[model samples]
Target: MSDTCSNVQGYVDPNWPRPDDDGSSCIIIYGYVPSFALGVLGVVLFTTALVAHSYLLSRYRTWYFSTVIVGTVMEIIGYIFRILASKKNPYSVAYFVGQYFCIVVAPVFYSAAIYTLITPMTKRIGREYAPLSPKVILWTFIICDIIATTIQMTGAGLIGRAYSDGKDPTTPNNILLAGLAFQVFSFAVFIFCLLFFLVRSRNTTDRHFKIFSTAVLVATLAVYLRTCIRLAETAEGLLEFLSTHEAIFGCLEFLPIVIAVYIFVYWHPGRWLGSESIHKKTGKSELEVSQLPR
Candidate 1:
């Protein structure tokens, strides 16, 4: 099935490492099983979110669900490509382009989840302490994300070209390094701004602060950890023996984001904001706000 497998009309290369040679092997590292499994997971999660959104139409707005759906779709697409690649080991150039680009870029939609939080936080914390308006933050980062994504994808394409050509790995390596560097810088700025807002709003009368703040803090920490691991992996490039060390990367990048997803689902920003708005508009006393809102 693999192009590499087809090309080898001659005897198999004994020099190549066999699965039997190493005690350590996994579907993620040695076969297509991992991609298929992950793809299924993505589909299930995406479908669940869609159903949840449909039922909540009256309770929350479209954009809240839209971002999650889009992010889930990106993840689904990425894993699909991975599954395809698994079926054919020496996958086409487009396979590399599609899979890695989607995998990296999907996180942008994750940031969209972060954006949904702001609308609610704005109401709870008050506009004065919101650090900046939701509109400003949303448009600013989304636009920048577009630009950043373009750079990263373009770089990934070039890297794929390099690999296809069998050129020195340096060309693609540099592009990957550049993209990761920019991503780290972008996330660092976002973290700084978000942390500043939460700190300033800590003492505010917003009832949802306790829940929202904790959720946000957890999400921020997950992003931070994901970025750090990405930085290290990209920096080492092909030189590192652990490039495909499945479990480590999985625990760091995939696991944290999964945790963040559950945290967000638990927090459910739209519900928090809606309840807060109802409380304030009804002119309920601070003590009474708690008793009736939930």
Candidate 2:
């Protein structure tokens, strides 16, 4: 605690660099002060997501959507911590780290929500359109998500320790980057699957497929935008321009995550994937694919 460079101390001083650091800059816990207004905006955005998701879950009973709610709650908690730190205790490491990683890993939960839709989507459109089985695709992304979350959480913990002990955070930062990198690669493969499915299914004329596909594409891309930015920011490390810049976090990270969770409000899975939906659309049953010749 005493080692904090200012309110929090820099491990590297620009004038007198650490043994390993380049002399160009220093590393500190927070590059700039946290903003109360931004934290409030985060809470408002996430709370709106929570309410919308909860309403959808209640009305449709798409229990899978609960993952989306869980992520929203975590985002709210993260913002609460941020709000507390913004004015009251900006230098408090507990609030700082808590706020940081909560937002960092919460995406994994909602990402799972999106990932699970692959099976239902394939069933609606036709399994043949995809190179891999929908279930296989679902499990693949889920497993990758679990691994990414684990790695990121472990790295977050090490980062806290690094700050407290005033030790080198290079290893922890690398661990975090590795996890984000893995997630990015997995998501890239998902984009391929989406595009492939769209191309193969383009000839089929199912209204539900169009809505479903568009929603999935929009939601997933929103998350991807946030994740890519996070990877860039973290790559810059603590106290660096990208890391400390609130504007980037608010505009890119928070906005995208909020958009991701809310997109489903209009495109709720139950509308297209529910048993009743099939009857509504075709007066039959759920139709992820074309009707068979009877």
Candidate 3:
């Protein structure tokens, strides 16, 4: 037994017989089943979202749906890496990097799509109600998303470097927490802005606009919930219960995102807001002025 332990060194290889609960080697022992299950579910949801976005693109010819598609693809790949990580080699550095990198940055694309929605919405309603012009809002929020993405990806890279060097990941984890907090703040401000527009708009009778706005609200809330969870999880540091526990991750991160993706698909703005025919026929001057990208 001593010979086997010495020969294996510090690594936990999945091909070898399972090792005893030595506090130093294994991060998780029996939670692979649940991880695999959640990973599979994530793949399925993201794939469905991808297909839906593709169909929307072919019919609507909107560039914004492509952003959602990119996010879905990232999510699918991220979960695939998580499934690999669940195969008894939870300590595998490759799997860890793949999962965290893709998952953490994927939502930035979704936020970009959300930001695009505001342009047409402000045009459809009234530009006066918005604090900034639609084009300004679009660029501002998308740039914020880019900054958040860079911060989170840098933190993930730092964490990977620290892991490889056998150093403490606390600093990188704090960086990740900052990125998550930034996302939460951005989404919160976005929601407030949307609410302000909703309250101030005189054209509330448009059912399609109302439904589209509701969908955007729900999706934003879902992402906001996930961001808050990630913020709390990372704020607790890598060794804490929220960071180590898989079930909590599945509930907070995975579930909220899946819900958000489905909401966007079912209530896709392109279906209503992207229709050139509807825009042309609209008697309202404000809605007529609203132009979706071809």
Candidate 4:
């Protein structure tokens, strides 16, 4: 990480040659290219989801669509910085700033997606089956998610400042650790809530119900894995284990998120909305039929 130290020194003046013995080669920048590429792919997929949702405004929920839009935009911005970093070793301070900011905020929309799922889930599975009220799920997890996001952003800023000031930014690892731990805690609570409701509503059955339930479970599991991987990465700092294992990051972060995105795409609430109209005639709630959340 002395390379980062030297890079910071050279970055202040903006035109200095990169440190020759600092262990960072220009080629190292390209090492991040695949992540940037995957980020772009994420943007496209999320954008498609947004547009499809918006075009079928009557069929899709606004909160879900908006969250997708915002998450996509964040991924786009994150990739832009990644590309910049690819082009410039250590990258410009501004590029690093944007990358950290956007990536950190992206998970907030994920939390929003999680929140949006709760009320609809309660409606679908019957509120009585829900382990916690929609209000409780919303207020508690959303607040914790927000706190995690704030901690991450602040930690990223502190690390940046420390690096720029020629101090050991790794000392602020506790902030990042706290944020990740908070996120994991929130997600664990959510999983408990989901499982509680799901088990309670097991009698409600259908192919679609099964599919959506599996999708929700998969998404939750994916996020949990991503959270753990991030925690490991942060704990590792610039250690060789992290630096040499790019594929591990990809599998832990990208693959899980891809699974999540695809789950959302296929298990969208649109199909069920039509079926709900049928249930209206029977004077029964969709909750009685399917416990799946949107």
lDDT of 2 at 100: 77
lDDT of 3 by residue, 138-173 (tens): 887787888788889999888877665556677988
TM-score of 1: 0.74
Number of colliding residue pairs in each model: 0, 8, 0, 1
Q: In model 3, where do residues sit more than 4 Å from their true spots? A: 1-34, 276-294
TM-score (C-alpha, index-matched) for candidate 3: 0.83
For 36-155, candidate 1 gives per-residue lDDT tens digits of 566556556655654564444335453553565566567667767766655543134455557667767767677766755666566556777766787887677667666766766776
lDDT tens digits, residue span 189-286, model 2: 88888788888888883677687788889989999988898899778886677887778888898889888887888788876676444534664333
Model 4 residue 232 CA deviation in Å? 1.3
Number of the predicted model whose lDDT against the real structure is largest: 2
TM-scores of the models, in the order given:
0.74, 0.85, 0.83, 0.77
| Model 1 worst lDDT run, 10 consecutive residues | 21-30
Give the per-residue lDDT of model 4 (tens digit) for 151-258: 988887786665445566676767977897788888888888888888888888556666777777887787778777777777767333653455875677657765
Model 4 local distance difference test score: 0.63
Worst 10 residues of 4 by lDDT: 22-31
Between the candidate structures 3 and 4, which one is better when assessed by TM-score? 3
Q: Count backbone clashes in candidate 3.
A: 0
- Greater TM-score among 2 and 3 belongs to 2
